[model samples]
Target: MQTEKVIEHIVGWLKDYATNAGVNGFVIGISGGIDSAVTSTLCAKTGLDLLCIEMPIHQAASHVTRAQEHISFLKSNFSNVTDIRVDLTPVFEEFKTEVSLDGNQATVDMALANTRARLRMTTLYYYAGLKGLLVAGTGNKVEDFGVGFYTKYGDGGVDLSPIADLMKSEVYELGQFLNVPNSIMKAAPSDGLFGDSRSDEDQIGASYPELEWAMKVIEEGKTISDFEGRKREVLKIYNRYNNSNKHKMDPIPICEIPSDLK
Candidate 1:
């Protein structure tokens, strides 16, 4: 589909979903990444009131700067866009300390990182409830489904995901079509959870482009080795994440009654 058509479809979908659900507006947590930037822009285009939130929890200075920049862009460009920056450092620290006392320690950096994602999720929901808005998610197809790169019940918790079917590469295309700020478009993708700055590729063991390629290849039931050399490494990383994160990607399980019992 053309980029313009994709934008039109997403905008229409958001409007229809909000009207059907009788929600007041769209609420989104902007992370200064291309995906969030695109999603927020799409929501803003729907002409409904939009709340663009910037939630920083022990975030890197660069990430915070980018987020603020995006917020500024939104406020300047969109009349219906309202935004605020909420710092969750104190809340996160208290939660971490309290959980540790209960034998649920945050010893591992990854554990603490996920805690940050969940905290942001909670903050988003809190505002969504107040404003009668639906929480718009920023996840794309590759991260949300192919590798399940999002934090389950954390960033994964959302009322709706507008771009969940778009690949990371496809998201970039939309970003360009939407005229997202070059700072965000050129910046490396990061979850902005950990204190130290690390791109998603650094944590995911493969770049978005590499993973996207691997996912497409595997989806076709073709061997990864068909592409020569280090490309094979993409297959290994892709398979590892695809298999391990199935739990995050799959729907919640429920107990099923036996046929006779039913």
Candidate 2:
């Protein structure tokens, strides 16, 4: 498939969907990661209202710097752009105490991480509400389809995704085409919930380039009978998330009454 044609098709899909849904814009969390930067740039090319939320919490100085760079890049390109920087330390701690979870430091940290992610999602949706915007997810094909590298109910909860079909490596290729800054593209992809030590690939135990090929074939409408070792491992990871977060992956169930009208 031609990459340029695919890019144009994806952008066109976003615009046509926005018009059909009666939404005027697309809101994306600009985390300074390649995925978000690429997504924001592509959305901008569509000439839609794009809001980039810079929500940082207990993150390192480098993350904030890169985020600003992304904002500057977006402003230079996109016509309608709003950059909102909301520090989430206070809100995170308050939510932790409110929940009353008495766990160790690791559990506490995970809670804080999930809190920050959900908080950002909430903030984006608020502006989305005001502007009749749809949240454009930043997850790539590898992150979304291969392994579940996103936070449950956080980044995964979005109206639509433009980059969900592209792998991480392919995303960088497209970013190069869009003239995304080399620094931003080469920087480590982080959740920024962790200061610097952890990363999506490191946590998942497989790089995007290593996993994308297998991901594409398995997700296609084809079957294999002899998937014993590596394929088994992939299924294990996929199954873990699929079982763990079934609620997040599915719609709410309607409760049935004892006597209901049919």
Candidate 3:
């Protein structure tokens, strides 16, 4: 899909947006995933101040290693890139102590995982505010629009999304073109919120390619009755997520006051 032209377009767009906004540059959380690696690289290409932050809360070793590897690669290649590692494990533990944990194990665990993402988001914004930088989001098309797989007010919180229009496969293509660290490019896609090795596929129950196909067919006006077997199963999975996470995808509900009432 004119990969080179697409990359140029995104880079130009980012630079223009930041200049128009009067921000120094961007700050992004490096998660060692394909999306972040590609998005951060795009930011670096703009030749603006790029701060790569590593905020880990009970994160897996592999994820941490890949994140560090990618950051190192960026620093070596880009003169404008800088990085910092913020260990939030203690902060997370303290937060857990203050919150209610009365729910069932699964429910409580899910909440805590989302908390991890929110903490990282807060950290990024904190720096953004202090340094006059915009918080750059790393979400892609499938995760951001198709499945709504990210945490609202958490990873979904951002000043701008550079890759939200690109599909997961397209993000990978950008990663390849950007020369992201091999370790990150090869690792399984994950949210890293659960502090485990569970891949996004494990949580979503569908590979990105499968979800991409489903998203395309659905956009083309296809229905569940048109497919069978595994295709049907994948469609069901995609539909369930798309429906349930619509809140994340849509604008926040605002109650409009009647003119008489006002």
Q: Each prediction's Cα lDDT score?
A: 0.90, 0.79, 0.95
TM-score of 3: 0.99
**Which residue pairs of candidate 2 clash?**
none
lDDT of 3 by residue, 137-163 (tens): 999999999999999999999999999
Clashing pairs for model 3 are none
Question: Judged by lDDT against the true structure, how good is candidate 1?
Answer: 0.90
lDDT of 2 by residue, 1-262 (tens): 4778888998999999998999888988888789998898888888988888888777788778887998898898777887777777777767767886777987877777777888888988988998899999999876776566777778888999899888888898898888888888888777777766577667665556656755666667433344667776665565565456556555768888767565
The clash count of every prediction, one per candidate, is: 0, 0, 0
lDDT of 1 at 145: 83
Among the numbered candidates, top TM-score falls to 3
Give the winner by TM-score: 2 or 3.
3
As a whole number from 0 to 100, the lDDT of residue 164 in candidate 2 is 87
When 1 and 2 are scored with lDDT, the better candidate is 1
lDDT score for residue 169 of model 2: 85
